[model samples]
Target: MGHVILVTGGARSGKSSHAEARVAALPGERVYIATARPEDDEMRARIAHHIARRGPGWLTLEEPFDLAGALDRTDGRGPRLVDCLTLWLANLMFADRDWSPEADLLIAALARQNSPVVLVSNEVGMGIVPENALARAFRDAQGWLNQRVAAMANEVEFVVAGLPLRLK
Candidate 1:
């Protein structure tokens, strides 16, 4: 089985950078499974920045909902990095889909992976409770998703200010 690593932190905490480094350090070709959709200009710019930072040595797959399917398709190809699971959860919620089943599928897929998988996620529950119900729901779901992934992961790192603190 492939080694599973989860890197999570607050916004702009360098989780993606750390996850990228972890995947790059692994053997075989590198695959980056991006879940972000360029729905607006700001998001488009962020996606571009990420693409530029990653450079040219990785195969990129844009799968916003079917992450489990993406992992299955790319299994054994190389080390795979799933950047920002929080965005994926948002995508699912916005689409009116239940996130738990998808999360379950993701965990199962990770267990079956033959190449290493490094996942990047945001820690959304650290801040004060949001005033809006939707925001609160998203925060709660994100926390649950992160915990589920961390439990399945062989290694877990919490990044803050560009530094990674191993949690598992």
Candidate 2:
């Protein structure tokens, strides 16, 4: 029913910038679905920076969790950008929420959307395996989430050194 584009990359690899640019070129007011929760000073600064980076044309919706619920109610007439699914995953993990149900809801919502959606995520499985069990579990969950989203996307791109390599 809608177009979903998946953008994945390593940290600081320009995934968000590319996703933003892709959605900004489309018509209608951009709806930015921010999933980051500012817990500390650095994180707060990061959130502020992200807000400042976006123009006044964007209607920012801060949904650290309940992303599926937000998407279900959001107007699908405009191109929406969900900046970084990785943090959303982390939030779910830390909150002891069932990731599968939330992920399923997100996929369902995406399938019903009437406009384009650019999903940003980190390619975490590419790096060395984690030493801790929790970290390993998070990585595994992230991989699963990315795989699921990629399968639903009309286009999938891997960003490296600020360059996008189309994967689908």
Candidate 3:
């Protein structure tokens, strides 16, 4: 079985950078599964920044909602990095889709992976709850997803200010 590492942090907490550094140290073909969808100019610019930082060596796959499908497609690759589950969850919520099934699929898939897998997710429960229902739902889902991933992950790291603190 492959090693599963879960990295959690707030926005701009350097989770992606930490995950990339970890993947860079591992052997095999690097696969980066980016879940962010560039729907606006600012988002597009942020995506570009991350892409530029990743350079050309890693194979990039953009799958906003079908994370399990992306993982299945990357079979036999060296290490795989799922850049942010929080965004993936947002995509699902935005599309009015039930996220529980997809979250289960992701967890099961990660459990059976044979190569190194690093999953980056936002730690959304640290802030105050939103007044609206949608935001509250997203926050709850993110917290649940993080808990599930952390439970299955061999290592859990919380990134803060570009530094990683191992939590599990």
Candidate 4:
């Protein structure tokens, strides 16, 4: 079984950087599973910047959804980093897709992974509650997802102001 790491924090809180650093310290080839979909020019540029930051050393897997399927296909032969599950969650919500089954499948897949896996997510519940139902629903789903992953993770870290505080 593979070791699971969960890195979560507010936006721009250095969660991705901390998660990448953890993966970099681990042995084996790195596979970055990007879950962001560039729907606009700004988003496209942001994605480009992220890809450039990782450079040529790591293999990139552009998985906007179907995270469990992507994990299954990768075979978990090397260290894998799934950055920003929050975006994946948003994708699911916006598409009116059921996210629970996929989240469960991902948990099962993580338990069976043959190599180390690091997951990054955003902790969005610390702010004021959203006035809209859809936003509230998304917030609830995100919190649920994070809690589930954190429970199963071998290590969990919360990042704030570029500092990581280990929770498990």
Separately for all candidates shown, the number of backbone clashes (residues 3 or more apart, or on different chains) is: 0, 0, 0, 0
Judged by lDDT against the true structure, how good is candidate 2? Answer: 0.89
What TM-score, computed on C-alpha atoms, does each candidate reach?
0.98, 0.96, 0.97, 0.96
Report the error of model 2 at residue 18, Å.
Answer: 0.3
Compared with the true structure, model 1 gives a TM-score of 0.98
Model 3 lDDT-worst window of ten? 67-76
Candidate 1 regions with alpha-carbon error over 4 angstroms: none
User: Where does model 4 exceed 4 Å of error?
Assistant: none
lDDT of 3 by residue, 1-168 (tens): 689999999899999999999999999999999999899999999999999999989998899988878887787789999988988999999898999999999988887778889999998887777999888988999999899989989999999999999899
Highest-lDDT candidate: 1
RMSD of each: 0.6, 1.0, 0.9, 1.1
Q: lDDT for model 3, please.
A: 0.90
Clashes of 1: 0
**C-alpha lDDT values of all predictions:** 0.94, 0.89, 0.90, 0.89
Instruction: For candidate 4, write residues 1-168 as lDDT tens digits.
Output: 788999999988988888988988988888899999989998899789788777787988899888877777776567899987999999988999998988998899888888889999998898898899999999999999999999999999999999999999
Could you tell me which residue pairs clash in candidate 3? none
lDDT of 1 by residue, 103-161 (tens): 99999999999989999999988788999999999999999999999998999999999
Model 1 residue 19 CA deviation in Å: 0.6
lDDT of 2 by residue, 27-66 (tens): 9878999999888999899889877877689988899888
